[model samples]
Target chain A: MTSHHETDIALDPELMAYVDGRLEPAKIAALEARLAHDSDAREAVAKWRHFDNLLNSYGRQADELPHSLKIAALERELASKLKKQHWRAIMLGTGLRRIAAGLVLFVAGWGSHAAYTTGGNMLASASHPYFVAPTLAGHAAFKLAAYQGAEFDGDNITSALDWMSQKMQHKIESPKLERLGYRVESARLIEVDDRPVAVFYYRNAENERVTVSVTPKWTEHGNYALRVVDLDDGVMAYWSSDQLHYTVVANDNRGAITTLAAAVQQ
Target chain B: MGLKSELHEHIGSLRRYALVLTRDPVAADDLVQETLVKAIAKAETFQRGSDLRPWLFRILHNTHISALRREKTRADAAPDLPEPIANDCQHTQLELKQVLSALDQLPEAQRNPIILIALREMSYAEAARSLDVPLGTFMSRLGRGREALRQIVQGVGRGKLSILKRKGDSA
Candidate 1:
């Protein structure tokens, strides 16, 4: 019998059940009769048994949980439960309960406003002095909403570049993104952690929007050479060259943006 | 017992699964912590009489998938070359390492089922239920995963196949 035939026999659920000792008594007897006659089926059963033994040996090497991690997790879980209980007790108290509810409503309203402005643009309005950059998912959600709401106008690319150069104290190169089938749309200057971030928006032939943000003089001290983050709306790729930090954000199609970033690096 | 105490009971199994999934101890700890936190937060969604192990595994699998997706995206975009696998180990360590390296090479879809069934010794029914897949699909994946693993481990001798190759190719 050929190897293909052997593979088929090995993958047979009944044969596997027999090897695993899962078959009924009658079924086992019937399979045994077949195994008596068919050398290929017997060989397949042997292989399955060997593989199963190997797996069992590996499972026996399962790592024991360290005391540090176990204690830390237990303490953290208890603390969190206590905090929740404390809040519940407070919420059930007299006048403070109403005040806390109103505070929650106020915070909810403010969160929505911070997330989006009236015209659906991300309120990237002011440069906060000590703003911690949001995760890539947060960035994608905000930037995606901004891309959809804002009109495409390639005319702003030059202004955006000039603004970046002036603020960052270094000239920024504009990669030939059009070569990758993306037409420059609009550009804006935003601040992250009080540092200048130049955002260039683009649209492809399929109308898929991409955002390339350049932060000059920025460096990631982490050991990872490339950092990719997945967001609800898109994906972001972060890498730093000698002169600038580049982030490519796109909805699902990261390859196109990665190519564009490569060109920018060159 | 409270939900916290109940969750605490499964920590060992959760950590083992996480360690096998992520080949990194630090990451395994983080994954376990995240899994437990999510379990506690969504405790109400879990049926009172349902088996907690499967529910916890489901949360862990989802979290792991998200992390893998992000890592794949990053690996694709980066230009740096992959580091070589170290060859300083003794023979037995190397053999065990090869087996684990091969296991790590399998795609998450295939790898998860094999780990659940072959290593964890979960029944087909339980493994399928934990992964929220049909029994037929789970079996197919497990079979294919095992075949691929067998090929990888058998084809390469000691210190020949680089673990980096599989991880890099995965991107």
Candidate 2:
């Protein structure tokens, strides 16, 4: 409702209302009559109209979401709600039923962990022989290049973990890498093969660089066991937990990288 | 339709806004998903029969701002200007890119007003309400944002600099 009148030309709120066609017909007529004699106002009106058109055009250019992503999102939401419902149902069961359910859940957890530790590696090698090496190598190389250039959004461990948690939608506990002589430098979110990955960068007193990348477990069939791959200049270790997949890319010290990976897994 | 069912209808609009805010498609999708999840989780708080679009947009805006804060990427973590899309017409594409780059320079406050009013075409009242700012403040921010855009678009070496200069002198 504010109007600025300067040097016989008024930069008024009506200009926007007029451009947006939100004014009453009588007000529009009055504004037009005034604009007829005012060249400056007319020019201002023209610029506002042009900007409006440009914005609408830009909005129209929005890309449609991929069908796969849409479907995945819906499925994820439904599954999450169903999981909550399942837990509630179990909690509300009879006492004997609750005890039986608890026993079943315990057995399931133990059995799965035992199976995972015993045969998970063999199954992964047989089924995904080509999966782990190339993906880990590409991820490692990308993180190395990013680390060498110090491309991170935050410095220190707290903010870095906080950022990782927000982006990945899961809490990321920073491992005791300081014990291994690697200090946290920075962290950022990066994408690899369409999956969101959170990469944390660390440096030591000797200036040795390391990156720990975490993402949700993308493959449903993989176990949380540790796997290591040797690179030309360094080594990379990958593991998963109940909820996440982790990769540690570090300098050529195999012992140091392995220790760091184990610490992260724990 | 039920509230959850109705919520699905706003996904496209939410996605467009998210894309503009994030300037990255992957991030945009993630933002949309997060918004949807939050909306569903907080559905009980939504008043029945109230307008849903603005309410949903408010949630999206809050989610985006919170993420930006956690990441500490932008100072205000206002939506950054997106890069221009690659169109077949080279000239138009370049022009759009220049406009977007100029948009990127505006702070989050000024930028959001322009986006809601100009790009999204929401009424001043509605946009103001969604942004949780008074109408007067929104209008001033929008005015400044438009003026900045005009200066930027005209300064793109397109031979229109004199026009803007004359307008500036007049004002």
Highest lDDT model number: 2
Against the hidden true structure, what lDDT does model 2 obtain?
A: 0.61
Q: Write the per-residue lDDT of candidate 2 for residues A1-266, one digit (tens) a residue.
A: 22354222323688777877787787988899989998767876787677666656666555455654663576357434533333334334353254445434533553544221212222135433223333344344444343232245434567666766776678878755664456776665655454556666677654667777667775544654455556556676666567877777676455455555655554
Model 1 residue A23 CA deviation (Å) reads 3.5
Reference-based lDDT, each prediction: 0.59, 0.61
For residues A1-266, could you state the per-residue lDDT of candidate 1 as single tens digits? 22686567736788767766778788888889989999877865675566555555554444554565554665466435543443344345464445555544533443543221121222242321111133232345445343222223587666667666787788986655674457877765665555666667777654666677666654543211334444445555555555666666666433333444454444
Docking class of 1: incorrect
Error of 1 at A36 (Å): 5.3
